[model samples]
Target: MKHFATALLCGLTLAWISTVTADQKPNVLIITVDDMSCDSVGAFGCELAETTPTIDALAASGMRFHYAHVQVGNCFPSRNVMFSGRYPHNTGVEGFYQVRDTQYAHLVDAMKDAGYYVAIRGKVTHSTPYQPYAWDQDLTIIDGQKQHIKNADSYYRSTKLGIQSAAEANKPFCINVNVSDPHKPFYAMSSKGQVVKDDNVPSKIFTADEVPIPGFLFDHPDVRKELAHYYSSVRRADDCVAAVLKALHEAGNEKDTVVFFLSDHGMPLPFAKTALWHHSTRTPWIVRWPGVTTAGSVDRQHMISAVDLMPTLLDILDLPAPNAFDGSSFKPLLEGGAQPGRDVVYKVYNENSGGNRSPMRSVETKRFGYIFNPWSDGKRIFKTATQGTMSYRAMRTVASSDPVVAARLQHFNHNVLEEFYDYQADPDALHNLIDDPQYQKEIEELRAEMRRFMVETNDPILAAFDKRHDLAAVSAYVDQVQAESDARRARKRTNKSPQQDDSLFRLVVPKQVQAGQAVLVKIRHTLPKAMAEQQFHVTLKNGDGGRVERIVKTASGDGVLEIEFDVPANLKTKSVVVSAFVGPEYGKHHLHRTKGGIAVTQP
Candidate 1:
């Protein structure tokens, strides 16, 4: 305990936290379920009876948000927004891939710096900026054994452990308990349709006939069976929630702790998981801040995004929020006050789990929703996690006989460039009113709103939006974005050290260069001011030192330095390493250095 305090004292940088005593600070407990829709809870409007009794109870005792949405539909990006108070582009976590060197401070970082004991349970990798996060306690593993994700009691034990450990440390607790139920490999069935046995069982198991089909999906027997499994998983998730809250009560911190409950995103199904539709981003946001929020209250007047979670919680604790946050504190809304500009929310999706680039942007209001998909060029197939589901398979089986089903499948495979939904009448987003002349005025208004959001956030796909009417311009932008995405994936794969991301310069070289041909080496940098008067020293050398070339050039005013070197015809090595150094004066101690590899071919 003494060592822990000493270590925290050494690392803690928030000097303002010292003014508040440990008892004055409230514990923060965030309970998140995976792949759950907002309508899945009975309190929110799940037709399936008792699907989430524990969550419904929490809503009854807390403040339920009726128009809460996540910034993204996928797991990692959505959870990252909840913690970092930033959009996917700002955090560089646009997909499932890890962004090791994030410029933003996370929720845990703020809580820990404020003299709280931070911990996490499940979704350990997805929730944090990177894996092996410096949590005061990782409840995922205890006594050298990893807790089972599906087991409801595992969460109870982990929560109890976190609370007791925080008590021992004499600090407020901020623990994120992520339950893994309601995701894929749901309750009773495997990834394949085979039945499976598990020790952890839901209190009430659902049958296909009893479960209600979501509005976004087709009504099929296979889909019904899948929904049955999903509902059963939701029930188990309810049990996990009950267990966690019970642990909090047992520790006698129920009133002293502020509880937050929400799903990472909507269901993991077609048109619901990865797509920027109504159900994709809508989340059941519940907050139980004792002594602050009125019980049994619902906030339907304001639309909140998951991005606001970080700043709002920090505000609740009276902690200073980082200036880089894209989200503002909704503490006023939670305190039964009104806030303007709560009528709309902005959403984005960049890449999927498989590293496929399908950039999308959207804006949603109470009555309308508009989405712009730059990657949908009518040729590139959209890849997502939903294609592997039973519902999609059922759609494929019936597509041959049903033209409607066939069209739906094709639309799912290749989306159109733009989509507009009358959300008031069609919450499922079943119909696209992009060409409806009656709603042209409303559609134009939504487009203007989306454009404002894109410009405000500095969205990368703004060029595509600006030239959406021109297919050629949109196609060019899409291609450029895809190439950049591929390059980023390659860099992340090869560069392990986070410091490599801090390099002021970037070197771009072709894969192969002829021995007698002129080779071009491009140096890119963001430090235009620092390199305005500097020079670039470029060198190309082989492993055996049989061939070497050197060139020096002044930095270009456009932040890109292009240098050409002629390779010797007598070059014998199969490859060469290209290195570039930027400095005001030529010397070994330069400002920045970058390297790339190129292959040598005989001409």
Candidate 2:
């Protein structure tokens, strides 16, 4: 009896210790706004009143950064950088398409491994590299009603539900609450200038007369009207912020939770979104950690990039990071310490949502900025989401009559080879100093910095940037990239099996097959001599989550191989993907791979 009692006491002690350890780990709450510029928030230098009362209050109660930037200006790539801690080039998420099976771990996976209950409210597809991720709970829908992305009240309910769900799961929560606002279809006013009736409305609406125009845009009446609607949407996003914080407080996790707030990028307007300008990448970053950060403090010395988000969060959670990360942890800066080599930030813009490529790279310091645009050969017209806005239309209308406006329009359409800006004096980036001999020395220094960064990061455009002075070299590189893009588009159009470059690999499958059908997959590859002596593996996966794998010997260094897979009778999806791998064994390190997909017809 005494032995039993002692054992019971020991078990109880260990259980208590475990509980305490879990409780000590702070909860993580990341709130992101869509298409919001740094200057939209009052705490981040917006002179406008009440544009972001809740966000401003949160900033006053925490630490706000003055020099924070995201790696990309588009939504999917930007958020991917924040969650993956890698640049777009490294993650293969340069645009809006899905990148499956990355080598590095995602932030959601890391948080789940650390015993946290992870959830997200909106932007589910945008935040992850691939679709159908295993999140603990998607707070976008609870019971029966869908959580409206633009409805402030829906955010309140969703956040409350997330907190409660985490409590029931008996684990700390890591919730991402992405608020959609200020992007497009902004809060509409009536034709008579009165607020329209809608289920989704901003807490406060502003008039065009009172709206402050962005420095990058001219003060035209149409521009001011659009800015008014944009600011109104910003106010609604702030309401969402207020709702999320209230949920945290009501759940009694305020002091024990660390809250992070920022935008995916700048506003979706001309000279902002989808560009590599200062306003395009600068974000309004705020953090609230109860014991670590001083209230109402602002950090202007260190330039924090979104790529550091994953590493810093992992550090804060006391979790192990992956073997490699492009970004370092900024935990020291959060603790009121300093970090070296934070004086400059590198920014990139690859493709847009429509798969249009306008590759750009820039390096920025507090006072100066330099951009390299190999795509801008004075002939190619730039296309972006902002070109669809009223502001762009208004500028087009006046350009024919006004030389200044005409010049601006011309520069916007066809960018020069290089651009140098004294951003400190001209925050709007209106004046280009590329031809000014007085700033040539500074430009050269920035060019060297950019080249070093590109070389170290192994940027695909390194060759182009190095030969930027040689138009023929630049043209050749651009043509090669364009061909690749065209090939991708052709693949989509044909819906046929893919053939790799140099005729080294090809995969062919049936155009359509029915349920329970025997599907034939054909592969032709020129394997290396070493691999020819080893085993080749093939995996056939149906869209319904069914997988079949096979292994065979590589008969020759160059030949064709055929395999068969049985589609499950209960298949529920409309497609299947086949992957061929050459390696020592199946599920091992692979030397090469080729993948293709086929259509599945219903029985």
Q: All candidates' TM-scores?
A: 0.78, 0.78
In the order shown, the candidates' Cα RMSDs to the true structure are 15.7, 12.1
Off by over 4 Å in 2: 1-23, 189-197, 493-603
Candidate 1 TM-score versus the reference: 0.78
lDDT tens readout by residue for model 1, 1-603:
223223322322121122234549988999999999999999999998988777887787778999999999899989999999988888888887767777778987888899999989999889887875767777876533568999888888889988877887789899999999899889879887667997888888999998888777778999998989899999899888888877886787877788899998899889899878999999999998877677778987899999899999999999998667888889998788999988999999988988888889999998899999888888999899899999999989999999988988888899899999988899988899999999899889989998898788887778789999899999898788778778977976564332322456778888888998888888876654644665677877653222266788775445777888888776644676676666543323245453434678897
Model 2: residue 420 alpha-carbon error in angstroms: 0.8
Worst 10 residues of 2 by lDDT: 11-20
Write down the lDDT that model 1 would get.
Answer: 0.82
Tens-place lDDT per residue, model 2, 369-487, is 99998889889988898898878988899898999888889989998989999999988889999999999999999999999888888789999998999998987887787677677
| CA lDDT of every candidate | 0.82, 0.80
Clashes of each: 0, 0
TM-score of model 2 (CA atoms):
0.78
